[model samples]
Target chain A: AQSVTQLDSQVPVFEEAPVELRCNYSSSVSVYLFWYVQYPNQGLQLLLKYLSGSTLVKGINGFEAEFNKSQTSFHLRKPSVHISDTAEYFCAVSEEDYKLSFGAGTTVTVRA
Target chain B: DAGVTQSPTHLIKTRGQHVTLRCSPISGHKSVSWYQQVLGQGPQFIFQYYEKEERGRGNFPDRFSARQFPNYSSELNVNALLLGDSALYLCASSLNRGNYGYTFGSGTRLTVV
Candidate 1:
């Protein structure tokens, strides 16, 4: 079984400022990592994923995440944030079974 | 190109009442999974069905059950609901077991009074 841990529960940032959401997971075997963004009362939208090959994976928007194998982390980062970037972010992990385990979620609030 | 669809976007039920949630997967997708998200929390896995068979289950109670139809649609039934059951029920669909960042539905908001 794999598990994800998102350190920050809430993050507030100014518009156009850079921000990073930290995530760590515990898995003994190979795992797949993903970041999803959810607006209020909406479904989750994929931000990016790390299956293999590239440690630095880019997704929609200006968001990106780096999968650190040794540290077992997949932290999401954005060079610049917009008001639209404010949303709840979740980091998930899955083993070979493809069953996803999600973190508690971090709420990002961007102010103008 | 319809994404996963879940019916009854909002529902209200009293404790001990039974509720059923429905979901329709994306076209050509054959796997469906159910998750429960409490307020201020991440989504918790409940059940996964593939090809009309049960594939995986989480730490939910026996009162929670689900079934998948031949068309890949699925239903989640919860018996003798509790107030703690009040949460957003999410449905996700994928083409297969491998990771494809399964498409998710808007989810059904179930409020158990």
Candidate 2:
């Protein structure tokens, strides 16, 4: 089984400022990592995923995340955040099975 | 193209009542999964169905059950609801075993009073 741990529960950032949301995972076997964003009263939207290949993965909305094997981390980063970037972000992991285990969400509040 | 669609955006039920939530997977998708998100928490996996068969299950109790239809639509039934059961029920669909990623639907907000 695989599980995700998001370090921060709330992140406040000024508009146009850079932001990073940290995430870590624990799994005995190989795993797949994912980041999802949820707006108010909306479903989760896939930001990016790390299945294989490169450690740095770029996603929609100018967001990106890097998969660190030794650290067992997949942290999300954005060079510049917009007001629209304010939302709830989740980190998830899946092992060989189909089910995904998610971490407690991190709420991002981008202020002007 | 429609993404995963869940029925009854919001519903309220009394304690001890049973509630059923519905979901329609995307076109050509063969797998459907259910999740529950309590306030201020991330979504927790409940169940997964593939090709009309149970594929995976989470740590939920037997009171929480689900089934998938031939059309790849699915229903989640919760028996003897409690205040703790009040949550946002999310439905997600994947082409297969979600090797890539799953498409999620706007969840059904279930309020138990």
Candidate 3:
């Protein structure tokens, strides 16, 4: 079985400041990792995924995440954030089958 | 193209009652999956269907059942609903079952009294 853990439940940052959301996972086999963002009252949108190849994955909206196998971590980062970036972010893992194990989620609040 | 779509954005039901949630996958997508997200928690997978057949099932009770239609749409039926069953039910669709990313719907919020 696979499981994900997001280190923080909430993170607040001033607009234009860099932010990072931490995530870790436990799995016995190779896994595919993903980051998703959910706006208020909206569905989850895929931010990026780490399937293979590079460890650092860039995603839409100027966001990126690095997959660290040894550390069992995949943390999301943005050089700068906008007030509109306030939302909830989730990290998920999928292995072999299509089922996904998700993190508890971290809420990002960007204040002006 | 239209994203994954779910019906009955909100619903209220009583304990021991049954409720059915509907979902329409994106055109050309063959895999449909269901997830349950309770307040302040991440989504938990419930079921996955491909080509109108069961592909995978999560850790859920037998009371939770689902089916896919010929058109790639799906329905999740919950029998004997409990208060704990009250949550946001999400529907996600993918192109295939190869560990690809999924497109999710807005989800149906089911409240059990």
Candidate 4:
């Protein structure tokens, strides 16, 4: 079974500032990593995923994440954040079964 | 195209009662999964179904059950509900078992009193 751990539960940042959300995982075998965003009272939307090849993966909304194999980490980063970036972000992992194991999630609050 | 859709955006139930939630996967999606999210927490996996068969189940109790239909739609049923069962129930769909990212529904908010 694979598991994910998100370091922070909440992060507050000023608009236009850079932000990074930390995530780590433990897996017994090769796995797929994913990031999802959820707006208040809304469904989760895929932000990005790291399947294979390309440790640096770019996502929608100008967000990106780097897959560190040795560190077992996939931290999300954005050069500049906007108020619209405020949402709950989840880090997840899945093995060949594709049964996703999710982290507790980190809430990003971008304030003007 | 429409994303995954869940029915009954909100529901209130009494303890020991039974409740059912519904979900319709995106067109051409053959895999459906269910998840439960508690307040201030990330979603937890509950079940995964593909081709009307059970593929996986989470750590939830036997009281929690689900099934998929021929059309790939699914229903989640919880029996003898407890207060702890109150949470947002999410449905997700993927084209195949190996699909990477899933399309999720807005979720049904179930409150057990």
Write the residue-wise lDDT of candidate 3 on B1-113 in tens digits: 89999999999999999999999999999999999999899999999999999999999999999999999999999999999999999999999973779999999999999
Q: Which stretches of candidate 1 lie over 4 Å from their true place?
A: none
Cα lDDT tens digits, model 1, A19-67, are: 9999999998999999999999998888899989989999999889999
Pick the DockQ winner: 2
RMSD, each candidate, Å? 0.7, 0.6, 0.7, 0.7
Which clashing pairs does model 4 show? none
lDDT of 2 by residue, A1-112 (tens): 7888999999999999999999999999989999999999999999999999999999999999999999999999999999999999999999889688999999999999
TM-score of each: 0.99, 0.99, 0.98, 0.98
lDDT of 1: 0.94
TM-score of chain B of each: 0.98, 0.99, 0.98, 0.98
Candidate 1: tens digits of C-alpha lDDT, residues B19-102 = 999999999899999999999999999999988999999999999999999899999999999999999999999999638778
Residue pairs with backbone atoms closer than 3 Å in model 3 (clashes):
none
lDDT minimum window of 10 residues, candidate 2 chain B: B94-103
Docking quality band of candidate 3, CAPRI definitions: high
In DockQ, how does model 3 score against the reference complex? 0.84
- What does candidate 4's lDDT look like per residue over B60-110, in tens digits? 999999999999999999999999999999999999974578989999999
Model 2 lDDT tens row, B5-53: 9999999999999999999999999999999999999999999999999
DockQ of 1: 0.83
